[model samples]
Target chain A: MKLLNKILFGSLSAIFLLSGYDGFSQAPDKGSLSVAINYFNDNNKIPYVLVRVKTKVNGKFKTVPGIPLKLFLNKDSAGLLIGKVVTNESGEATSFIPPSLKKEWSATIKHSFHASFMGNTKYDSTSADLTVGKAKILIDTVGRSVVATVLELKDTSWTPVKGVDVMLAVKRLGADLNINETATFATDSTGKASGDFKRDTIPGDLKGNITLVAKVVDNDQFGNLSIEKTVHWGSKFVSKANDFNERTLFATRAKAPVWLLFIALGIIIAVWTVLILLVQNILRIKKLGQEA
Target chain B: MKNSKSIASDEQIIQDLLPRKFKTSGRIWVSLLIAICLVGIYAYYRQLRYGLAVTNMRDYVSWGIYISNFVFFVAISLVGSLITAVFRLAGVKWGAPLTRIAEMIAVAAIIFASIIIIVDMGSPERFYNLFIYGRIQSPIIWDVIVITTYFFISILLLYYPLLPDIKILLRFKEKSGPGLHKFYSFLGSFWTGSHKQYLLSKKAIYALCVAIIPVAFTIHTVTSWLFATTYRPGWDSTNFGAYFIAGAFLVGAGSVVVAMYIFRTWYHLEKYITPDHFDKMGRVLVLLCLLYLYFNVNEFLTPFFKMKESEAGYLNDMFSGSFAPVFWFAIFTGILLPIIILLFKQGRKPLPMFIVGIMVVVGAWFKRYLIVTPTLLHPFMPMHDVPEMYHHYFPSWEEWAITSGSLAGAMLIITLLCRIFPIVPIQETINEHHETAK
Candidate 1:
């Protein structure tokens, strides 16, 4: 009886331990973090961001490589100059900061590879503090060549301003600027204008800033200005166009392997059919023996 | 010169084999069975009026006593194959007198097995859905097909052998009432008792005996698969089919032993159902019990060995927890105790064997309950978000009424069968007697 008790106790403990181990192993891990993001864009504003990490690595503050380095802004903030772009090889990024006097301002650099390593820096820089002349404007267009399409400027009310003439211009770095050449267009019935301004026909050199001026004929409504906005263009802007083309090509190349998958499924079915026949034959013989 | 003594002619055998009208006690038994059946029918009416809600079964115990009772009936029905087909195929001459009794029990139990399963269904009204929407992969469909085949084969097996007896009953129209006499004649009027008819009947019986073996196996195997196919810890095992079949044969043979004892005692059938018959049946029951015990150990031990995460809770429940007492009782009474008791020669006497048979039948009923309900209670998800009543099950009055009705109904069939036909095969008994005399 004592020996039997010892054996029973030994078996019981072993079973408990094994069962506990299995339960622990199958429990789902819950430590990993997951995130979701939403982006907004409009006619005046595009959802673009550049994220760079300035971190202390190997005892030196260095910028991280291969960060997606993009920026995003809410759709309501489209009228404000928002979003940013990364620097090309020189470790500098360009951004169009909207001239808002509000101090609820922050900048985030989002990285694709190190998606978890998101960083944000808040600044109290207001439009009054940062003088208009000292703030440099950078324009990064995603198209290979600039097309001077209609730039229909509307207020928050969305009403078109008649007889509001607008001057549009472009400049590129390391090129001659033709300041004498400009496209003058007016808003249509639906607040839209379209015309082409050639890169060579631009004033000064192609390397500098392109300034657009909307000179209002009458200041009937709000005390806003016939504002002049200058945009600096560079070579870094051209890669975004190439990125779009590459994605399209990659999607078209993925259909051939899908057909091979169906052929493999047919082969599997054939093998299963043969196995079923063999098992049925064996069962039939056993059944006959039982009857006999 | 060699045939100096006169032998009992075939007419004497036929006259002895003819079914007789019921006596006072037989009439009383039939009336009692009918009364119980009426009460059961009223109970079923209440259940139909109120839905299954009239039962104590809740969502957690969705299947209560009805399913276990169904399993019990199916298990008991398996004896038909054991006595009629298995014994005949093995040329066991001693089993000849018991064959019709066993076959009658099989037919009665299988008939109620079908009825009780329908009673357990939530929508007996939509029973046609079982055929229309039947999934071939489901064990229920397999059970339906095999059980139907087994029932018909069992009926044919019962009928073909009775042709000679039925002709004898038809000739003695004075012993039977006008109504019953007409019924008997209608059933067997085609049987001329010619040599060709006898030969044909014998061939058909042989064919049915052959056909019923697999159908019998398939019925119980598919019934086992109903539980085995599920992924529950207690149920998910390849051994279930054999384990179930073993237990089924045990309980079925045990019931037969009890029936043999009762019929022999009540009808003064000692001349036909002898003590030797009881002794042989006791041995058969003991063998079946031991086989079932071995399978039970295999079914339980390996799981107790590993006790994987999924099986641990279910094993704990059965082993030393809430379900422990019932589990051990079933093990001891259904297999171990019967085996131990039937091992002794004196214990194999009719009275003690009858007691053991009752124990086995009751224990096997609880064993089937353990098979179905406990595993359902221990599904992968924790039992939550249901009413408190759903967590446990006890048969409501309506459920008891219906279940009791089914049992009484089974007894009623056997009682009616015995009233119409000789409970013991007179011709087979006389054949044995003549052989002994020679």
Candidate 2:
């Protein structure tokens, strides 16, 4: 019995300790952080650089959320800070170029950007730089055809950039629709690409105006740059207004389907009516039993 | 002389079944169940404090053992409708002795069904929102409505029949402890045993019996709709409602058999809950098991035959993958083995029937687990982006404790209820004897 008790106590202690081993384990070793930044100028209206932070874990790149990223105009230093943002759930942060950096941004013909992340105890600090020579695509329309001319800013001059690919598409909320069957239009020596708009009539706003966008995406020389031109070349589209009063399954509680309300109310009435009658019967039985 | 003998037998039968005091073994059994319930309560407190994060459920397997446990409770509770409403309506005369037992199990199961569902809801505080913002078109709302209706009807059915028994207990008031005497009076003091009162009580019970059948079917069907309405590959089926109903009746009947055997053995009411009762219940269990097997074929065989690309993975997982053991075990033990055993005359004996009853119940539980988990794991879209742990599921200790607690809690209710009332109806057994003697 003594031997049995000792063995049993030993086993129980080992089990309890092993089950809570995680609570006693050492702190986790940190992984090296990978930071990358890209610049997007959509008609220069919404100019922002998105910096993404990721770390390889178990052979897959997982997003490192809550990392603070700082953007610089041309140097990885504090004085030229465009903006600062903490990474969100997707491990990416958007920092819009502030007015304070506009002077420095315009001073350099070759536009460059830098992003840096200060490390914590879990991760090593890292920085990444990207330089996309300032470029823009100009959209023009000639009878039944749309055209885009790509230009790069050199020293004091905007020269036509050759052999660069330009994609002309109809801009929408989601992905852009191709203008034609052509996959991509590579700019010729003249730095011009054009597509015909006679294939299909796309629906636009109530006024039938569509924004045609010409973009140079992931260009080796000029990064993501897009310019758009609005034209009254689309069929008028009227959005179907939401009717909260509509009665359907998917509708709100107040707008439950009429058949459903009727059936549900009917069943509830029927079942509860039986239940109520039973209650009355019980009461009558009590009254009769009292008389007895 | 015959009159004197009838009176003596009636006295003897009544004396045989008055709620007796617990022996040491009984106290120990009740204590063990109470311990389990306490552990479950503690686990629930932990769950409320830590949130669902304490559970092993994740993106891929969101509905785990909790949902399955809920289904098991709801399914097992269906036996009351089967033994009480169905048998009474069919005029199965022998069902009279077992009516209260079935009703007791049903009432406890349904009450815990409501509770276990709330336990599954992480935001049980918002339960009233189910009513205030409830949509009639949603099957969940329908389930709530029907379960509530079934609950009241079941309570009435249990109560109406027990009125006579309560009057008998009132006669022997001194035999009952002080608290129980007051409870008996509070519950049924108004039942004065008048001819008119008897007629009225019978009519009320009859009405409830008639009312409960469709509500029982609706409750189970609506529960199945909670799954069937989803377009997930395993859940998308028109046959789910009937299938769930069939399975409910089988598991419920199985539980009743187990309860019947236990009650007969413990209470020593061998004259009332006889071997003949076991044989009859075994036949009922056999029919239910066969019916469930038919529905199983309908639920799975067609899906397997078509081998639709969407269903292929789920079917393969059930047939040969990680879930294969549980799947085949449920089929063999819950359905096939019960039928095979109960089909034989010798196998319908109490001991064998009890073992088969346990097998059916245990298998049915794992079957619910299979119904819930494998489908969730085999979604139409591939499982990705989630941590590797999410791809597989095994309930954490907290989940097992709470689920086991809900089960033990149900049994505890049945136990306390048994302590309060005679396991076999004293008055009804005497009435049956009087009618036969006449």
Candidate 3:
């Protein structure tokens, strides 16, 4: 009996110690961020950045928000200053970056946060050594699109096809040399097509020599169609363009929620449990009476 | 007149009626049952080795013949409650000789019912998960809870009535060996046939009878809900609970009839298990079959008329589609034919009733099969992008071995139970004889 008691005690303590180890192991790391972002694609790309700056509030002293931040493409000073904007309520600012920088490059965000007493606040310059990859462009010709507004295809729906290669070829009427201007483009979610033509890199005189033709070669395996369209040189000509906007915006509507079914199932289970208990108690009482 | 004149004294009767060692045929039967059981064990080992892939089950057809067999076992076990409790409560004297037999069937069937369910589990190794991670929300959990309760109650009901008989067996030391004699003594040595002990045992039996009725209902009802709670078309019906219960009673009563015939023939129990018993059991089977047929109509005909988009595939599968033959066979053999045959007075005799009983039992097995398989084949989403084999299901050799093994195991338990104790309670039979003679 004494040996049995000791064995029981030892096993019970082992179980408790094992459970405690599991509990401690499950604690989340405090330093890392668990972040997920959803964004609407104008053309096919959405760019956001994670910016962290140190401060003199209590811990590691460095920079803060709302300071002038500049992004340079390469070692050359010829790179454009993208934008200057203040951080919002979440101490983060998000904006659309031009598609011209589709290749690898590094960036830096410089900012400062003030101390409570307005003393010498630390200036923190945080640099993110980054590489920007090309974003996938999707086009859906079956679902609703901007062309529906113009064409009034009310009966038809347009669906966007994703991951197809599209090429836009252009030519000019006045040039003695046939300027074969070509830019690869893809479609967005609503099948609206867009691509970067790199107009800023070309001289102003040769810019007018551009006529655009978009051709989608292949559709993805899910039956999404690929489309190609041509843009003429004389259509909405805007000269002296500094940055090329290759983004297409599509409209989106909210879907019905999926949680109501689960709620109904939960209620049914609760009612069933209660009914079982009630029946058991009633049966128990009757049994006791019969024995008496 | 001559047989009546040769009536033996109580001691002579007890000596003649004590549980004896197995004869040559009995030894052969036991050996065969044990052999089948061993084969089934090996089959189960293979199943454990290969996972559920050893069976023909796929994602689309998650459940298979094992589940149907489970339902059949649970259904047949209800005979114990019907014969022992319901008949006893109603003061039906003819049911006295059959009570122990029905209770034995119940014990054996319920034991296998539990075993077959574990065989059906995908991770039988993690069966303790049902206790540890058991969610009250799942119908499977409810089934486990009620089945265990029903099992214990049925065991006590069988045990209480057998106490007097155990004391009688203890008196015959040569027939019941030293080991079994000691066992009987240990179990009922204190049962001295005292008035207080009799009162307590009687009260306990009565209480279990009352308690078992609801638990019996809950066991089958929860089993029905395992299907009804799911969104499958043929299975998702309000009438499923009643349908399952009615079918269960029919099968259970049918099993009792069959067992009564077997025990009567083999043990020369013609005087005990009378023709009147078979006639009465026949009448009970007819009523249960009719009730089951009514539930089947409500369960099937309503949906068939509506032919709702969700139910259309499942209904068609059973009606005139792939499963038409099995469906029609179950209806005809399980309910219609048995009801027609048992309706006549001559048909209610021992021989004809025995035939009808076999028909009901076999048909009920297929009926459970139809209930489980066809609905699973018609899940909401179309089966796609999986292996071609996933679209169809047929039980593998391992499954067949295990299923047959469970059946043999049940029979073996019943055989052993009869060997240890009188299949029909000798004391109760003698008491009833005294009452009738007086």
Top TM-score model: 2
Estimate TM-scores for all models.
Answer: 0.61, 0.79, 0.63
- lDDT (Cα, 0-100) at B342 in candidate 2: 97
| Chain A vs native chain A, TM-score per candidate | 0.21, 0.71, 0.24
**Which stretches of candidate 3 lie above 4 Å from their native place?**
A1-292, B1-9, B12-16
**What are the per-residue Cα lDDT tens digits for candidate 3 across A1-292?**
9999999999999998898676456554223121211122223334434333334544554344554344434332334423344444454444344466444322332111111111123333343333322223332222212121001112243334444445543433563211224334444455455444433333323333333333332222211122222332323446665323421111111111224335434544553454455345334533543454
DockQ of prediction 1: 0.02
Residue A27 of model 3 has an lDDT of 50
For all the models shown, what interface RMSD does each have? 17.0, 1.0, 13.3
Per-prediction DockQ, in order? 0.02, 0.59, 0.02
Runs in model 1 lying further than 4 Å from the true structure: A1-292, B1-20
The candidate 1 chain B region of ten consecutive residues with least summed lDDT is B1-10
TM-score rank order: 2, 3, 1
Specify the CAPRI tier of model 3: incorrect
Q: Measured by C-alpha RMSD in angstroms, how accurate is candidate 1?
A: 21.0
Q: What lDDT is obtained when candidate 2 is compared to the true structure? A: 0.87
